[model samples]
Target chain A: MMDFINFYLVPGITLGAIYALGAVGVSMIFGILRFAHFAHGDLMTVGAYFGLSAVWLLGIPALAAIPIAVALTCLVALFADRAFYKPLRQLPTIYTVIASFGVALIFRSVVQLVWGTESQVYSVGFQKPIVLFDSLRIATRHIQIILATAAITLGLHWFLHHTQMGKTMRAVSDDPALASVAGLDPEKTIRWTWIIGAGLAAIAGVFVGLDTDVHTMMGWNLLLPMFAAALLGGIGKPLGAIAGGLIIGIAEEICTYPFFGESLISPSYKSAIAFVIMLLILIFRPRGLFKGRLL
Target chain B: MELSGILFYLISFLIMGGIYSVICLALNMQWGFGGLFNAGIAGFYAVGAYSAAIITSANTPNHVGGFDLPIVVGLVVAGTLSGIVGWAIARICVRLKADYLAMASIGIAEIIRLAVINEEWLTNGSLGVSRIPRPLEEFFTGRESEMVFFVFVWIIVAITFWVAHRLYKSPWGRVMRAIRDNEAAAESVGKDVQSFRTQSFVIGAIFMGVAGALSAHYFKFFSPDATEPLLITFLAWVMLIAGGSGNNKGAVAGALIIWAIWSMTEIITQQLPPDWATRSSYIRMLLIGLFLQFVLQRFRAGLFPEKAPKLNVKSHG
Candidate 1:
């Protein structure tokens, strides 16, 4: 039982932390933009590729590559906003959503064109397993993932609460027009939000790739889980997104171990677990678990 | 090239376009009329295709197959199953607003795909159930078979379009449009917004199912790979968006135009140098993406926008 718990629960929390990082980015963007940025997953993919490129080109260590990738991803986000999103700010919310789908497809196709359709593994060389309490073994990579996620989450919380720009971001999320009237530049705030969100997505993508090889489909597949977390936590609520991610991750892991010996649920269906959770939450409590304002 | 080959390609393109037209019309109904953003239409389409194929194909061990049900019955069952799934999704997600509904629908679609891929006992796993029978194998063979299949599908498409046209002008459609434009207003006006949306979604799924069944029979093969993102989901979106969003005629026209361009470009790419061919395919996808962005940017109303019928209110003196 302890062995099973260590294998399943520990790995689940690690995976959940990665998902939470992606979800926070998604939630933050949704909070600020008032539209679901479908291109977010592809953005994550782009970030992974960027990190891969940096690792390959500069011979940077895997740990060092992450921050570089994050910076580059932020730039990409800033550019994406300037190119694709800024023009559509005046359009209807639905239109922006649809346009984001277009942007997502473009990003996906571009990635495919550049990287080819083949999956590539970027080995960060962190394969050591740490012994925990003489009975449990945890991967060093997993520890990194959890620690990185916690640091980022705490940093984001602090930034949102204590900083001037963070307050402006919150104000914009609460009421864009009102925030604009109070001498806050909505466009700049939105640009910053995209940068921050996309930057975090890159971090998650790079770390996930470091833990488990880089693939073009990594970000696309992660999109649903991230959305599930964001919706589970409450749209636009960062804290909610993190908590939701952990819950989804743990639930998915637990579901893989079927109760009563009915046969283990396949890990492929782990995504379905998140979907089910999302559907139930949306049906019963559309405001999500945290009951934040609708995006 | 021989005239017969050219004719064959033309006829085949139209037939395939007919299938897409049916799918797009269903999407138009839900999205254009009812304001439901269903990103998972392909999942239902895949289900429809697989359901029909499994019912009619030869049975394999560890699963129910080789039932050899009639093609029409298979089609109906596919549509019904898709409708049921859609209804379930609607019950779970229809109450949510547009963005949330879209996300939920997409999640449901991914779940369906996952189930299909993982449930080896049911769907034969990724190997997929093959040897699906055509509707009229004995009467038609070779080119004749293709032509006959084309005509049969065109007939289905025509009927679907006519039914959709009649339904669009009906009171039900008006309520759907009202809900699409303003859910609160429609609800205040005594329409059960949820039920209406749910019913519309189910009906659309039925049409999508039928389209899938036609595709399966036409191809005579089924696979989990049939439900990939670009091929099934994004292609449908492109067709619907390129055509007029709300107009059936526009949807059909858009499918034909896009399918024709897609096929022609594919053919041309094959004739090019290997390096160029591979490069051009990516270019083509980029172009499509750009075109969608361009349309969204410039022609927000689409190629053929849905014009609201003017009410001739008599001058109040």
Candidate 2:
């Protein structure tokens, strides 16, 4: 039992952390923007590519490549905001959503055109496994993932709770017009939100690349899972996304172990697993697990 | 390259446009009237095409190929299957938030494609089913077969358009539009918003299914890859958005113009230098993407916006 638990549960948690990062970004963006940014998954893919490029160009350690990827991703997010999203601020949310889909398609095709529709592997140079106990072993890379996710989550918590910009962000998310009247530039706040959100997505993407292999369809494939996580956690809540991701990840992983004579659900269906959970949750409580508004 | 060639291409374009017009009209009913962003239309299209192909093609001795059913039966079955899938999706997804619904629908679409690709026993895996029988082959004979097929497809398109128009003007259409504009308000008036939207979605999907069957019969071949993102789903979105989201006439018009441009560009690009042509396809997609963004930004109302239907009642109180 412990062996089974360690093999499935621990890895699930780590994978969940990566999904949580992406989900938080999606949730925050949805909260503030009032439309789903469909291009976000592609943005994550862009970040992974940037990380891969950084590793190739600088010949730096994979650990060091992550921060560089994050910075580059943040820059791209800022640019995308200016070019694609900002102009559509006054339009209806539906139009913006469609626009985001266009942005995502453009981003995907560009990636495909550049990368040649092939899967890429980024060697992080960490091969050692840390044995946790008697029956279970974990990879050092997974440890890095867990630590990185924890640090980012804690850091975001601190930033949201203690910082002025964070407070303004919260205010903007809560009520944009009210925040605007209270001397916050809603545009600037939203831009910063995109930067932070996209930055987190980049970090998650790079980490996921390190954990597995990077592919052109990596982001596109993850879009549904991220959306599921975001929806599961309540659309606007960061903490909710984290918990939601963990639940989805662990549940899907554990589901791989079939009970009785039933066929085990394959890992390829991981995205579908997350979506099914999301559907059920939406049916029972459309507001989500945290009972928040449908941002 | 002669006058006859031009005429032939024009006729082909009209036929192709007629097929796409059916797709765009279906999408219009969903996105325009119902405000449902269905990114999974491609999946339904694939299902329809494959259903028709598998049904009409003669089954080989050593392989699963087709049932050799009648063409009309194949078309109906395709549409029915697609409608069933749409109904299932609507039952599951119509109650969710708009964005969540879109995500779910897209997921469903992806799942369908994956299943079709991976389910080797049923769909013959990636090799795809082919040799679908055409309707009216006996009457049309050899050279005139194409013309007869075009007429048959155009008749179906016309009937679909007529049904769509009638539905739009019906009381159910009013409820669908109201739901699209403001769901909360519609709910306040005691309407079963979910059911109405689901009906619209299912009906639209049936039309799309029929269109897919038509395409399969016309092409006489199909593969799982044929139902990929660009061809099935996004192209329909482009046609609908370009035409006018809320107007059937606009949707039909948009599909023709966009499809014509798309086909011509594809042909022209193919004739370019090999290296340049290969890269120009990417450019073509980029242009479409940019066009989508530009149109959405500049003219959300579309080339031919739907004029609000005149109301019969006026009150002074």
Candidate 3:
């Protein structure tokens, strides 16, 4: 039991944290903007790269570069909205979706152009796992992931519940026209939403990079699972995203469990597991777990 | 270029264009008429290609397929299976809006790609199935055979085009367009909007299957790499949108134009210095991204807008 918990459950939780953070950002954008931001996964990659550059140029600790990366990614998201998405705000939602695909492509291409196709690590020294029990071991990176995700999620909850801007943001997301009529500044809310959303996404990206290696394809690879987590949690519900993310993470890891029999399921099908779970959820509950808008 | 070289290039271009036209025409039915967004075009295409490849290829000891079936039988089976898959997907997701369907399709495509890669018994794993039977392979060889296959492909594409064109002008087409314009209005008029959406989606998937099978036969081989969504699925969307959705002629034209640009970019980029060659693909993608954005922003209705159906009655004013 300890071996199973250490091997599968721990990593799963860490992975879930990444997805939860990313899904929250995705859900926030979906709620406030009412369009599937397809470039979002690439935005995470951009954030990770920004973090990598910070660590490289500033000679700072990998952990310390998180704030710098988050700030920079927030600006990029803002600029992307103003330049690409804002121009087509009046168009149909499908148009925005297509534009997002284009943006995804452009972002990915820029990453490939700037970073090439090679994978990079933040700092190369390997840290031995700390033994928690006779056999159970935990990596420092995994611990960091859990701690940081908890802090951010808690901070987000507080912000949404207590802060004036957060309330205004939620109001706008619920009903932009009504919120505007009620004296909330729609543009300001939108800007702050992008900031918080992209900042969280950057943290997720940086942590994932730390857990594994930073590569141009990391975000693209994560996009499906992240979207699954978002949709499963309910498109616009932030807390639900965390729940959905954990479910997806556990399901994916469970597929590789030895009890299943090695021939029964391959680890390569982990993404498929996430997809199947989401599809099944959507088939039964189209609005997802928390009753987001059906569409 | 020499006359023979030009002829060869044109034949190759049109053959590729014909396959893409089938895919784009199918997309026109979905996005243009049905208002359904499917991001898994490549997935369905791969299914068709692999299905047909397995059915027609020579039996190998390592894999399950190798029935060596006839070309027509393979194509039919490919399209039918793909249509059935689409039906299943439509049943599950037709209620959702276009973007959700888009996301779902992406997931579906990735799953299909993964299945193809990991399931060695069916797909032969990464090695992929080879020696797909092309039409008229026995009679002609080399470029001559290719030319014959080219004509055969165009004939199929033409038939598909004619059928799609008829559908576009038919009453059913009007219902589809009606549902697309306003689902609630169509529902109020007693049309089963959901059923029509499913039908259109299945029709589109069938066409995609046919397109995939045709391309697989032409290439005489297929692997997981050929089915990348970024290359096949997104490109199909670009073709349909650029050529003008809701217009079959525009769809075909868009396929040819994009294929021309695609091939030209490849050739041009390959000629650059070695370092630049690696980067050229990214440049190509960047340009395509820009082009798609430009089209969406400026020409949402596409170059040739869907023609308003001619009303028989005269204006009473």
lDDT-better candidate, 2 vs 3 = 3
Worst 10 residues of 3 chain A by lDDT: A255-264
What C-alpha lDDT, on a 0 to 100 scale, does residue A55 get in candidate 3? 95
Model 2: clashing residue pairs? Answer: none
What is the C-alpha DockQ of each candidate?
A: 0.72, 0.53, 0.83
TM-score of every prediction relative to native? 0.96, 0.92, 0.97
Kindly list the per-residue Cα lDDT of model 2 for residues B253-305, writing each as its tens digit.
Answer: 89988998899999999899887887788778878888998888787788899
- TM-score for the first chain in candidate 2 comes to 0.94
Of candidate 3 chain B, the 10-residue stretch with the lowest lDDT total is B303-312
TM-score, chain B, model 3, is 0.97
lDDT of model 2 at residue B195? 96
| CAPRI verdict (incorrect, acceptable, medium, high) for model 1 | medium
Candidate 2 lDDT by residue in tens digits, A65-172: 988988888988888788877888886677778888888888877877776667787774559687766666878888899898899889998988899988887777
Best-matching candidate per TM-score? 3
Q: Write the per-residue lDDT of candidate 3 for residues A197-231, one digit (tens) a residue.
A: 89988998899889999998888888898888988
Best by lDDT: 3
Model 1, residue A148: distance off in Å is 1.0
Clashing pairs in 1: B58-B66, B59-B65, B59-B66
